[model samples]
Target chain A: MPNSTDTPSNDTPSNDTGSFNPTARSRVKRLHERGKYDEASVFAILDAAFIAHIGYVIDGQPFVTPTAYWRQGQTLYWHGSAASRMLRFQEAGVPACVTVTHLDGLVMARSGFHHSINYRSVMAFGMAKLVADPQEEAAQLDLFVDRLYPGRRATLRPNEPQELKGTTVIAMEIEEASAKTRSGHPKDDEADYALDCWAGVIPIHQVVGRPIADPLLKAGVAFPKGLAGYRDGARFDELLTTNMV
Target chain B: MPNSTDTPSNDTPSNDTGSFNPTARSRVKRLHERGKYDEASVFAILDAAFIAHIGYVIDGQPFVTPTAYWRQGQTLYWHGSAASRMLRFQEAGVPACVTVTHLDGLVMARSGFHHSINYRSVMAFGMAKLVADPQEEAAQLDLFVDRLYPGRRATLRPNEPQELKGTTVIAMEIEEASAKTRSGHPKDDEADYALDCWAGVIPIHQVVGRPIADPLLKAGVAFPKGLAGYRDGARFDELLTTNMV
Candidate 1:
């Protein structure tokens, strides 16, 4: 584990700024006050969900692929088919950017110019390379499953031989990172607050729908307790954070 | 307007494949069957939301920035502060990829190997250029508002003089693009269906919460009908699609 993120802070002034030193790439140039470099702040954004938009370059053309992602300590992990062309290009230790965003609400300012969205986002820059070892790769897969589902891995059938060979896991230790967030009501001009207009937030949320059982499942098979966190109407990110071990 | 996206197709096999020809850069090599090449397929995915992850490279490093986005005919648009570093970097007609994804559901299979998430996503590759013309830039900003909120543009206060110069809008014509989508239940191995496991799809939907009135709003200010589509329980993407012109 990297000492920067893993070590407990002393609550000093330096820790407030964070242990992850901002670089030219990770720095927030516009509205710099919103930038957060603390490990706790960055990890909270990453742990809230398992989806990420990975940015990478093949030749000079950039491609952004949205994929499932998880973080353990300071290392970020994502997997895809071993035969995947994108994975092949990334396994060569490519420089990559992984970004996660959560849309909170829409801020309706009195004027069209002040309209904005409330959100929390993190952008982590790192070098991505393959987890080539079979034993290590298998463990990472288990983490991906158990991380979201808690104890679900123990109840499921084991991976088949072909399944083992077909999956490719990529690991990237975050070298530079930054988190940006905006929340609460719109910050309109002081005078505009008195305008005769409907100005407020229409909050946005990702909620859980009912869990559907497969048609072919055994009649007696109960809904797995491991995934009990997915109950209907629950907040999606909160459930993930609640289940995060 | 480009005939490929605008002209009605005759339901021929080629038209079903899409009017947008797949190139080496935009082709979906893995799961080729899931790849969509036609203009309608690509535009549907793009119009479903106002957010996109833009992939652009600086020097040899890649950066993915999530920003509000809108589509008009063959072109796509997004805006940010004029002083924004990412916007400045992209204003020079830089090669970029704009990706939009909607998480639809979580598919739980009998085995961990078959577990997957259902999603609809589009990747459009193009050269991003600044909308330098003040007249065109102003209209695009209005379109951005009225696009999501319908006629909300007319009810609001006019833009300030500084707001015009403070915002930078970027436009990218869809040069090469592809849409990949997966839906429904888990397609597990046929034999695994007999396993004593609860395998099904837990549907995921982005829903709207209650609209919050600004604390400072006047008592008589009514909720705009243009934004009535944002009522609670409406699916966010569907609402955006409904409001889309």
Candidate 2:
């Protein structure tokens, strides 16, 4: 494991520290100040996001790939094509920046200028290494599957040898990171409140619609209980985490 | 105005490109067979997203801010605090990368290794300039307002002088860009079709829910008729453009 060094003060003072918040590492940014940084605050934002924008450089060319990711302790795991340019360059040890963001709502404040979105985002910088251990890769894969749909790993058949050989998983430990967020109502000046402009948040959320069964789902193999989060009218992320996790 | 350099090619390649797709423009990457670049393809993805990740370097520290954006022709405009560090450093003529992405659905194939999400994303590299002209800035603000709530511009009070002073609108002309997308069912190997694993797309989408009016709205000043799209639960970006433009 690589050690993280905290920059005393840098160009972006917001992210000079490595940790977001310790006490509430999982939900730090979600429930804290927008721009403030602590160990717990940053880690929470990073763990909750389902997808990430992975940035890396190859042949002096930079590429950002959107991929599914899961965080375990301080390390992040992602899998992709064994031959992808992004995977190749990333495994070679070039520094990479991974970002994940969640949009909460649209804040339509009284002043058009003060309008902003309520969001939580995390940015992390580190070098990724290919997951070379067979046992660790299998366990990480289990966690990755459970993150998206809990309890499915034990229900599904085991991976075959050829299947395992074809996939490539990479791991990256968090080196430097920061979490930034904005939430709640519009903070307009008191004087501007009487300007007759609408000022409030247009709450935004992700809700899962009715789930459609597979066209070829085997008869009598009803939808499993753990997969109920995909049903219609479910509140996407919330249902997945609350009911499944 | 920056001059446009047009690249011409004869042999139409179905894939991304083969050294002929305007490689001189630094932002455009030539993935050769692995690339997918088309005008409508890129625009559709860009137009579908309301939030973009703006990445820029200040004093060697990189910062990525999530901001609301509007695209007019080849120009992308976003507004923020005039004194904000993001705006100040962005105006220093540093090269910036803006990325917009929409995750469509989850693709689960026969093999667990092939699981991926169908997504569309675009990344553009350009220099952002402050919208210094009063008339131009006003027009852009109006465009932004119109974007969020179509005819609301005519119904609501106009921007005050102090409000304008507090706001900073930045516009970036597209220099070079690339769009990539993945869609359809999982691409499982022919032999895996008989593996008894579920194989199909779990279609994901962004659907708008009921609109909640501000609690303090004047009794008579109800949601305007021009804002009908906001009620239909259309895709966020489509509703934004139709209502504003």
Candidate 3:
């Protein structure tokens, strides 16, 4: 999601448009047209969701940990206890592959070979950076609150250091990445289209139900105005994307 | 998601129950209570979702690929072009981590430290196995079509050899795995409950909209009975879970 951080992968070959250079490891090999290397496109896909599956290695075994993540400037961050194996291993600046995906539709093609999916996904490669500086950690902790509830940070009680004492946050600079997306109806073979089988797109959407207030909430407290956008039926990605804009 | 693949990790201590014995790498380290090693629990979580992020390594660089996947017996399968880098690299039985997650709610807390998420996630680890035999590949290919569309496989045209000529299917026996879940309302600090800040949960749901038929569908075509289970407003997980049941 590096809009201005478009300093292409070191000395790799980048075209004039400021897109990421397709290195041997980062290029999309299949269905090449669906691959996107531009920062704006990558960032939009990244911002649409706060959840990601982080791929990292411990020994030779690869582990994909699904966690809530946030992006600030060119860096990406996720949190866990200081005791977490992932956080502990990442402190030494291990390579990390952070991937976020939004599956949008069920594509039912006339033939099994043509069936596909519609999704928006961003796969980023980078070295994990542990926020060891106390000041940087404190600042980032505050930014995490604003990720979803933008201006509400000013109104909420501050986190007690002890409350989050053992937690650690890890960051990555999105060194090299690609965004891949597919949408719309399925593409069937020309001959198969004439078959009577039903073939179409069943669009999938993640929507929010009405917010349930805490039972012990104060008498005069109303739903935070900063979070009014999270109404019933509000689309999750739309809320995050709107906040990005 | 294995119900009968009950053999625990070799030489690892396990209680009387048939759940997978947690080894050094497979155990959930943080919130101990949320980790479920029993087969039924793990399979339910895995069956509820059809998409997974696979973590695999090429060189020392890890890559996370989000793909559509299906489960049968104790094995998990996902497909791609035979020439795809991820598939080609995984053909040699690489150590892979497949993770599936359902993010259910956003927990808004009175204090930043108490904020959390309600989610159901499954992580499976095993060596990748390429389905190389032609007959085995053909059978698995047929199973893939039925994963989402159930009995509609009987109504569709068979895939031409050339249609899927270069595609490959990869399988991994889910040797060791764990399911993690969290639900219910926000757990805020006792003193923070008296604060005026809003604290609650915005429940998330993935639902289907009305299915759109292909524009070129024949005039006499009707929605297939096998797919009638998929209707407007059906929950994506519910659809899959029901089929699994």
Give the Å error, residue A161, model 1: 2.8
Model 1 bad stretches (over 4 Å):
A1-18, B1-18, B243-245
Ranking by TM-score: 1, 3, 2
Give the candidate number with the greatest DockQ.
1
Top candidate when judged by lDDT against the true structure = 1
lDDT of 1 by residue, B1-245 (tens): 01011212222224544467888898988767677878878887888877899999999999999899999888999998888888899899999999999898887878888788878889999999999999999999999988878888887778877788888999999899998877766767768777888878888888888889887887899888667788888889898888433
Residue B189, candidate 1: C-alpha displacement in angstroms: 2.0
Reference-based TM-score of each model: 0.92, 0.80, 0.91
lDDT of 3 at B150: 82
DockQ-derived CAPRI band for the predicted complex in model 1: medium
Worst lDDT window (10 residues) for model 2 chain B? B1-10
DockQ of 3: 0.71
Ranking by lDDT: 1, 3, 2
* iRMSD for every model: 1.0, 3.8, 1.1
The model with the greater TM-score, 2 or 3, is 3
- Residue-level error in angstroms, candidate 2, position B37: 2.2
The residue-level lDDT of candidate 1 at A76 comes to: 98
* Residue A40 C-alpha lDDT in model 3: 72
